[model samples]
Target: MSPTMTEQIVLTAREARDVPHGEKGKFYERASERLGISTATLRRGIRSAAPSKERRRRSDSGRYALSREEALLISATILHAQTRDGKRIKTLKDAVRMLREKGAILAARIDKDTGEILGDLSDGAIARAMRGYHAHPDQILAPDPVTELRSNHPNHVWQVDASVCRLWYLEDGLQAIKRDAHYKNKPKNLERADRFKVTRYVVTDHYSGWVYARYVRGAESGENLCAVLIDAMQNRGDRDILRGVPEILMMDKGSANTAGMTKNLCQALDIRVFPHEKGNPRANGQVENGNNLVETTFESDLRFYTVRDLSHLNKLARMWRIRFNAERLHSRHGRTRSMAWLDIRQEELTNAPSAAACRNLATSTTVKRIVSSVLRVRLGGREYDVSQVPGVLVKGPLDVAYDAWGDEHIKVVRTGKDGRPVHYMAPLAKRGAGGFFEGAALIGEEYKRKKDTPAQTARAEIEEMITGERTKRGAEKARKEKRLPFGGTIDPFRGMSEKDARPYQVPTGRDHPAIAPTVESPRLTPTRLAMLLRDRLGRDWPEDGYQRIVARYPDGAPEESIPEVMAAVTGKKATPDLRVVKA
Candidate 1:
């Protein structure tokens, strides 16, 4: 039989290994020719078929002399020495030396048998042990995992954020907050300029990346927040496409954002307010990035251009924002923000109310007032005639909201039969001379009265049943004569009085049976009883043993009777007076 190629290769490799080191190449060349293969192939085959060299390992390989606690202490020391910016000032060796000086770690390991000291501790060894135990600075300081968010549509989610523009302030005009000898970033300079500092409010649509920015003088407040939000929501102009109310408004948990005024505005607009957790600005990163963009792209031009006042700055900002949204291509959608937002369907976009109405909604709180006898309600120091509003009754409490569009009228909110709010615009009542309503009939010329509400009719029926009169005058006369509302024909305490007056025969002492003494037993949980049984039996306890015990004593076993019960279940003799101790 002829030798196989593998066997020839193996024989060649054996011969090559025995050849002198310098002549192995020549030997491989000769073998390649004989084997009808290239020299490189023959060498590779020889290398593969030859036995691999054994690398010796030390006795203490893969072992660390430093304990996990010592490594952790060293890592903690190094971490503690880091600056606020996370720059490490101390190295591992420095940490080990410091720890040794403080006696937190030993300088060397001592042998337990001979008390002989080993070599000085190695920083490299400590570092390796730290990496092995996951106590290194990189491992401990790793960032938490982040979750990416998605938006369904342009107006589905909007992020609003406020940031202080540290560059400029609006005093007489736009002035730079220069960091010079006179106006450094000291407490005095910052405190004096705090009121005049420009706060930039930015709103970004999460899906389209369209940004709306407005510059406000002074610090952030609920009024400023509402003003910016209103401007962003309302129609800007024909050219600007970012308008309408968003379904969800996401912001930080700032006091101004979560204030009652902001909440009321969002509620009135039917927008859900979502405040992200504290210290997590990434939740609203879109707006945060919008702020940065505004600062870099728009505000960066302020150095060359002139900004007369906050209004002027806001005007320029709006213009730049519109152009940017209409021109710049968004990286995510690969189109201009305006074009992306234009994809919104008419039904998906909710048209916002007028600026005045939105402002009123944000600033004013809903109030409750009862309609007067003349079918009027007072709101915002103005009396409105609600007589024309359906379901409104005299002296009935109605939910009234301010009408920002006109001071001559107010909105009356009422719950309809379907449990939804029905709004009515109630016009302000005109008062005639002598404090009478203008629409009222003259004293002698005419006579007119409002129709009675359902409550009034019910009251009239009650009066007729009680005082035997349907007219208000007659009902008043009956009331003056001391007539009760229910006609004074019923007694409320008759049954109680009859029962108190009735006599009952008392039971004789002999008729009562003797009372038996009842013994109270402490309740034991299934696990507790199982544990006790296991400890007493000193053997493996099955789950069925607990089931049997529960079935026998559903209420609980008395502590004193535990021994007898255990003995009976285990088929062993009961111990004398053995009681289970309360744990």
Candidate 2:
């Protein structure tokens, strides 16, 4: 079989590569002439067909000669000089120069024989070293690996985020959509619109991608956040199908989202609040994408329509959200968001409380009240009869919550037999015209007696079992005859004191060996005495004179006897005079 063009080129290139270096041009010319092509084209083809040899590498390849500490120092210096936005203001050369000048880094090379620095350190070397050591600014500032998250069912996890609607603003009770031609680079227009900037709060179900949005005037605040959340959780008719408290709410760690009121509301509804780490917006990327979706699909059309105010904008947002969720097909599920949400089981979906009740839960704390002897508890300036609540006891503490659906009643929470919380609707106690409780018997027209409570019945049974009588008179007679409670069968201190009890032995302490005191010799050295004499006489004394005085004294003279010692040594009355000298 005849060789193909590629194979022929490969054979020619192999022959040319093995030829003598000086005759390479002649070899290429001969090959090109035989192949009936130009020398340049043939040479190119030969070059392309030849497999390149692997380049040689040094033993220390991919390793930095610079120590890790030096590389880290260079990186830190550059990073420290960067701006708040992470723009590097200091170049590698600049960093190297500064560090070299400060004696923070040494020359790149040294002579092994002479022990002298022989090579100058360059910025390129430092940069290469940083890259090799993984201490470069780029490597240090790179984003961390993202963790993929998932949801088990609809409403299992929801993400909420707020963004300013920079394209539109409320002015003169109407929406003013900004145009790039007029407001793109105009600072004055932006400044004016900043006063009426619209903030959009968006929430998305992680599982189904269903979205809910609300627009409000001004910046994000705790009140606005809570209001948006409450509205999103309420059933807004059949058009808007996404409504319920999510099992877990994911949001940015903004002040409004982490506010006490926001946490309290979520807690009241049994929703867990999860705030993403700072500088990690992708942790709640679902809601962020939802924000962009609304901006592009819904708000883009607002310029063609008229919006009266914030309320009108929110109404439009609601309508758009409903249509978007119902019509738009989700890329992941291959179905509309509404349909995907409908796949949730009945038990997995939790119905939200009324708007008024949710608002109360957000703003108010659960009030604790004690039930009165009459089986009534006062809450919100009204008295409610809790006698109908199971396990209700007089003077017992009860948690009271506002009943937004029924103003005439309040909800009471108590522990049930199963150890879970039980809720009850307690009606307002009826009051008579004279401010007295109604249901009392009239003088002659009616006769009525209050029903005995569980506590009252238990008390009567206990009295009958203990005293062998149910009547008050019989109980009193039995108590007098018994003298002591429980028929004198109970002992208050049965095991406290007994005949076998012995007195506790006092612990005796052993005396420790006495330590002799250390006595220090009072004899002063010649140098010390010389210094003291110099200070006392206001003049320096000879070294020999101080030595002679110390020798004569044998035992060191006390500090107070310095004057006498000086007089005895000098053979004259020496009156020591001292004076302070100011510098």
Candidate 3:
């Protein structure tokens, strides 16, 4: 035991004066007793009153032993060895063992009594080092220096996620649980759970902190998530103006964040997706904070509302979302969500995709599949005919970008002579395996499907002779007989003529197939200018390079026309053929 503060103070005074305190034995002993110390302790305390040297910590000494570089490597390995939920799958011992296996000799401490050595890289030491280094992520693993997340502008980025509601509601099956106290009810039936728990899917603008939420009765499912996202993409709420698709979306590694959904959503909306680091909620802090608000601001007052079903819960949630957007002030801008959203210029908010488009994208799935010899490709345990995307399902299996689940439209990524994406024939869904083949593109009169004439009947006979025979024998037999590339669809032409067939078109000149839509400019469109540029710059010039040249003249798109694209493409020697512009 150490001496009391009073004893230490008095002892210090005595030591400074060189007083003979121990000489008065009874007096010192009584003083020591009063101070909760012995006479010997009192004398030692006085002698130690003069400040002694400070003892250093073990970490300070060993800090230099493990170089910062090596410590970071070990720490990074441990960090990355975590699961999606952020649980460490690899232990410190495992990390050390791996380092040793890779010929990295680490420091160790020896047991004084047993003469055994233990590696110095303990879990606690690594954890402490990590905490120190997290303050400076620049020295460690980080996103590319050029790529950084921005949250100052609307549509810059948006974060989405789902969380379990903190409060429970009166579910249908179990009235007994709801009758008890908030903490009371515990049910043991399959139809019921601990009172009730609901999932809340939230979407928030990273810049404005505007939020949209949906409450569901069941677990966090992908279908429900898709529905909520579709709603957010299509509808503008009563008070909130946060409607358009974000330029980039941030999310965690939840099942709903699958590649199928991401690719379709991103492609359809022309947006980008940045999945949050595994188990790192801070990366998606905007929406995560919003989720907490869903619990605190709304769910906290659950007792006030007479909640009936998931619909009622969602109704209440929408009103809460409206209030959160219109009434609540944002910390960053000191403006309400609606104000921040409205502050953005109208031109910045482009066209919002229609509800039909949302449905199509939500159902679309992009899969890398090989087109079979029978002009068919297998996917999701079913084979689909590729007759419409490429008329007659030509031989090779190129990149197929299609959404078959809904409209079942397919677009074969076929390149042109300049090796650029060309709009090929838009093929309809083929029949078989619960499928159907529609018509092809209707860009021009030439693109229109040739009505079945005497020639087509003979051609169909020849097609059946080659495909039907081999298809019956199977794909292997079809492979042997390459005469008919693929078996024709059951209704070959979907049994429809130009008189009443559905309208589908690919807009491009026969000589130069356009990759994307023509720009709105009357004088110069990207597709139109690229054609002229390509003519001047040899046949081998890249299509994108020409497009870039057209884009460089900023006046053309959404502004005055600039013929700089032609001037830049055709050098001084070449004469400018000011071809008349047409849409």
Best by TM-score: 2
User: Model 1 off-target regions past 4 Å?
Assistant: 1-65, 80-91, 101-117, 181-192, 366-583
How many backbone collisions does model 2 have?
A: 0
Candidate 3 regions exceeding 4 Å error are 1-148, 173-191, 194-197, 259-262, 365-583
Model 3 lDDT per residue over 1-583, tens place: 3346755656544544543656556656766786776778776765566454466767655343344666667766777887877577787667767986886645355555896865565656655555565622234446444443566577678888988655564576212234444443333543454336677889998777888888776776667676777777665654656777677778887777764665565655656667777857678877888888887888777766567777777778877888778998988789998788776666666556676677677677444666555456665455565544533333455565554233355545555677634433234435443343344343465365443334446665665565665233454466576644545435456756788867789787566575787666455556655665565567645646665664575434322433455555443333445454444
The deviation in Å at residue 336 for candidate 3 is 2.9
Q: Write the per-residue lDDT of candidate 1 for residues 334-443, one digit (tens) a residue.
A: 99999999988988888788888897788777789998988998876778898888877877888887654557878777777976455688999988889987898887
Per-model TM-score versus the true fold: 0.53, 0.59, 0.45
- Provide the lDDT at 258 for model 2: 80
10 residues in a row with least lDDT, candidate 2: 574-583
Rank the models by lDDT, top first: 1, 2, 3
**Candidate 2 per-residue C-alpha lDDT over 496-527 given as tens digits, one digit per residue, 9 for 90 to 100:** 86676897888898877998898654545545
Candidates ranked, most accurate by TM-score first: 2, 1, 3
RMSD of 3: 32.9
